[model samples]
Target: MTRSLIIAAKCIAFTCLLLAVVGVSLWSASRRVPKFYEHALTQQLPADELAEAADQLEQEVLDLQSEIQSQETWEVIFTSEQINAWLAADLEQKFPQLLPTGVSEPRVAIEDGLAKVACRYTSPKFSTVFSLELDSFLTETTNEFAIRIAKARAGALPVPLKRFFDQITARAEEANLSVLWTQQEDSPVALVKLPTNLDDVRSDVVIEVIEIEEGQIRIAGRVVPGVELQSMPQQPRFADASQPR
Candidate 1:
């Protein structure tokens, strides 16, 4: 073969080897990164194990209950799968009204920093689809969780989620859910007031939604100094409400 042809063949071989190495490196990197949601669920405690954990948690809480009557700070964490399962259960029971009249068996999932809700509603005349992506956070004020819509759609049309804020607030009020909500920046947010009822009022407790990460949320609650958690009448409330007055 000509000298030029020989050099060209050598260059081709070198390029092929370089490509193979890069491909292997990419594959290895992908495998090293964890699949957040799937991994979290896979590590979830089984039914019997979860029950034992819950029992242990309850006992611990009861043991410390008396000592915690005074000011104290506490943090609670729940795995994504556990929380999502509870949310699905709660949607079926506690928030039945959340489903439209014709909708049945709605499904809800909390993961990847958003709550995905889906349901089907049908009527004699027509049918519709309801879907929403929601993200929640806490304002500087204690005891308030603010929910914001990331996206919403209904039956071949895009819906302005913020437009539905008042309706949601009204519905929540009518349902006596003990929540106050309004529109902010053309978006709707619901604030769940703590110390829900007059009779349950206790010490100056400040509970807030602190952080929302890929597979979990962190809630931090604290009691102000010099106050008995069980005796305080009203917990401090968030003022902004993330809405226009």
Candidate 2:
């Protein structure tokens, strides 16, 4: 072939190859984008989908970043997906369990300018048995050891069960669930505080639950005004931090 013709053919081939690469890149990008709700597609997407979207989002973000750097018109950039990731991480860390203080699973919902988490909690068990009639059993231990054994084994142990519901205000505050509070429409997600009537009062002092912050649950109320509270920074010497060795 002639030199010019060969050069032209090579140029055409290179152009076709470049076009193919561009087409493939754009196709890949489009595939990564979710077709669901703009917000969910960005934030609450399932794991695999979120990963794909994240890849695409990262590329787009890089492109946008460059554009912003050069153009100077687009100064601010905030994405729902980014916000969701942060929230998910925080929630996972704070509310890792579903019992004692949290619901089965964290349900995300928004209402009236607040992000409402419809979490559930069941009060811990508290049973006080004044007497199990151990005296009767003790008196006849030898006479009817076999009968007593049979009775204890076959019969239901009298629990004298007493159960009731109570609020989980203590755990909620400790998890910093209050700090994330925000009015609905403030962002892609916000916190809605669940109503709780928890008290810090004891027999000796009158303290009411005021607010929750940091690692401490706040209590503000009359305490006999000048009544000294024995400092308990360190619990009594016999306290156990965990199970008995």
Candidate 3:
């Protein structure tokens, strides 16, 4: 073979090898599961315990609703375990349509003022654990709060911000909640405004505080005289895994 032809052939082979390595690296990274998600999957709770957690969450929601109706000050706290139990045991079985398509097995971890929400995402191309690191706090506006998306990942690989924004927008629309998009320190933040009143309840609900701690979240608010409010959505009971499908 001519020298120039031999050099050209070597260049092509090198390019092919480089592409292969890059492809493999990306595939490996995509399959890497976050430690928090892995732990959530491995830890098994007894049926009775799971039921208790779900019940606690349900009762809290009901209490909050009752307080709103009575125009009283209210505070509700939820633990990570309680929320996870509700998500796993009740959400999918009862309100399957609540979550967008291709998302399942949702779980959350809250610590150091940040909440990590992870879920299993399945697409035709691949399946992976998708997670979002979020920081939520009350903004200056009344009943308004910001959930900043600090980072989003599919497994260990960083995912595009647009993907999460799209999902957030869809969810807000589905729930009839108002969400405004803005930037905070170069990170995307979703500003959520809680309606003062529900269609069925004419009392104004004013949210005053949102506090997050290790493994727990507390929200305190008050209800006063006002016009119409959008009724909050109802929650369904969760079926235990041991139960018949």
Clashing pairs in 2: 113-183, 113-184, 114-184, 115-190, 115-192
In candidate 3, stretches whose alpha carbon ends up further than 4 angstroms from where it belongs are 163-167, 199-202, 227-245
Residue 191 local lDDT, model 2: 22
lDDT of 3 by residue, 1-245 (tens): 69999999999999999999999998888888878778777884688898889889999999878877775788899999999889878998889788778998999988878898999989898998899899988876667787878988987898877655667777887788877677767677777777776665666778888988899999998776643224432221212211111
Q: 1 or 3: which has the higher TM-score? A: 3
Among all windows of ten consecutive residues in candidate 1, which has the lowest summed lDDT? 30-39
lDDT of 2 at 93: 61
Please report the candidate that would top TM-score against the real structure.
3
lDDT of 2 by residue, 1-245 (tens): 69999999999999999999997765454333111223332447676655554455456546644543344232223243533443444445664663444223223232222222222222343221111111101111111110010111001122211111013224556754331211112111112132222233222222223332322122233332213433312122212212111
Q: lDDT of model 1 at residue 166? A: 70
How many clashing residue pairs are found in candidate 2? 5
Give the distance in Å from residue 245's predicted Cα in candidate 3 to where it truly belongs. 46
* Per-candidate RMSD, Å: 13.7, 29.1, 9.4
TM-score of 2: 0.21
For model 3, what is the error of residue 93's alpha carbon versus the real structure, in angstroms, after optimal superposition?
0.9
